[model samples]
Target: MELRVEGLACRRGEAVVLRDVGFVLAPGEALILRGPNGAGKTTMLRALAGLTPPVAGTISAPQEAMAYGAHADGLKAQLTVAENLTFWAAAFGTSGIGPAVAAFDLGALLDRRTADLSAGQKRRASLARMVLTGRPIWLLDEPTVSLDAANVARFAAAVSTHLEAGGSALIATHIDLGLAETRVLDVTQFAARAAARREADPFAEAIE
Candidate 1:
């Protein structure tokens, strides 16, 4: 499925930071979101993921097609690794967890509770859930935190395979994963103008 956005604008806590943002992500493609700190990369991803409403503009994607991963691992501390995978797979109506487990080599930790795992191990488990999602569009925000070089490569490999299977990913990260058919969207180009800030929030006093 193709994802398209046009004249997009978003806010971070009542302050409009990005405006007029647009991009098209076709199948078998990846787009890297690049911008300095506070440039609204996370906001953009959140809006696209339907976690937050955009201040303006539109995001076009099929229903049940977007899978979003934010900075939080989205894991249940009480659940074992395998159980966590099973739960997410059930939510997406997909039963295959083997590929997800193999993608990040989580076999050794499957029986262990998430709270007992080390930070890096936890991160790998969290990211591995993406494979089980079975969603064509992945919206990830800073997905590589706490990961070492080798694990980072594992993530890159997973993304490559996803794209090869005609999927698409939109990731916001500072580290470059060096994947194929990738493009960068510098959101600073869409930095909201002064007038846009006042429009994002209604209760705030107008700026003159």
Candidate 2:
């Protein structure tokens, strides 16, 4: 699978958050989107996932791509860990939840409600849902936000395995995810470009 973005730009009303960003990611390859706060890293990820429309340019992604946003959006706080997996598997038309549960080390927490799980546990459960999607491309935004060192290592291992299996990933994070042969794109450049555009017009507000 491959993902290609050409001159991708996103705007919120009159403010341009991202502009003229381009990249191509082939199967088994990964790219890390790095920048300081408000650099449009999260916006780019959302654009790749088709959750937010790009103000300009185009994104070409495989039909099977899946995106895991910064928040653990897929988890149902009312459901048990096992139930959540089961629901995700059904939604994705997968056979079962065995693999996902085992992959993320959720076996022991199967009976626990999602609300009762720790932040790391919730992140793991969210990752398990992504695995169950069986998509070849993953767009992850700050995937390791609340993980401790041990769980961070575990997340890295899971990502390594995904890449080894012919998957591709686009991650937006400040922390290292430990992916091998990963490319890095500094989104701050795009932000700077946006800033330059505003300098010519003193009345224009610079996008953060």
Candidate 3:
């Protein structure tokens, strides 16, 4: 399986942050999206995940085959760790939460409510849900947020295992996740200057 993006463009509200971006992610491969802050890394990830529609071009991948993890750890605050994993298990059409539980080291925190867990614990729980999704393509935004060095190593191992299983990952992060064999997409060239142009001349559109 593969994800192909051609002439992709992304907009946040009235501002266009990305334009004419293109990339291909092949099976058993990983792509790291690198850019300075506000350079549209998150926007690109969201567009690839089908959460936000591209203003131009195409993402040639079935929506169901992609699993997305955003900056926010999307957990039900009141639900216990195990319950959260279980909910995602059924939602993503996958069974058996044991592997997911062990994947993120959630054994001890399983019975605890998400609201009661620390930042790292909650982040792990959120990531464990992705394992349950069983999707081939993982679109992660700042996936290593709040994780300690040891936990980061665990995440790297999980990603390695997924790749070995013929899965692909597209991660947008500031810190290195220790993925040695990965492609890098620097989005600086794709940054849309239209937003700044519009700011300089509000009436520029009508005159042109």
- Candidate lDDT scores, in order, read 0.90, 0.81, 0.88
lDDT of 3 at 121: 92
**What lDDT score is found at residue 151 in candidate 2?**
79
> Per-candidate TM vs. native?
0.91, 0.89, 0.91
lDDT of 2 by residue, 81-183 (tens): 9999898898889899987887778899999999998988998888888778888888888888888888788878877888999998888878877789799
Clashing pairs in 1: none
The number of the candidate with the highest lDDT is 1
Tens digit of per-residue lDDT, candidate 1, span 18-105: 8888899999999999989888899998888877788899888954798888889999999999999999999888877899999998
Which window of ten consecutive residues has the lowest lDDT sum in model 1?
199-208
True-vs-predicted CA distance for residue 69, candidate 3, Å: 0.4
Question: Which of 1 and 2 is ahead in TM-score?
Answer: 1
Q: Could you give candidate 3's per-residue lDDT for residues 2-90 as a string of tens digits?
A: 99999888988787889888889999999999999889999888888878888998988898999999989989999999888898999
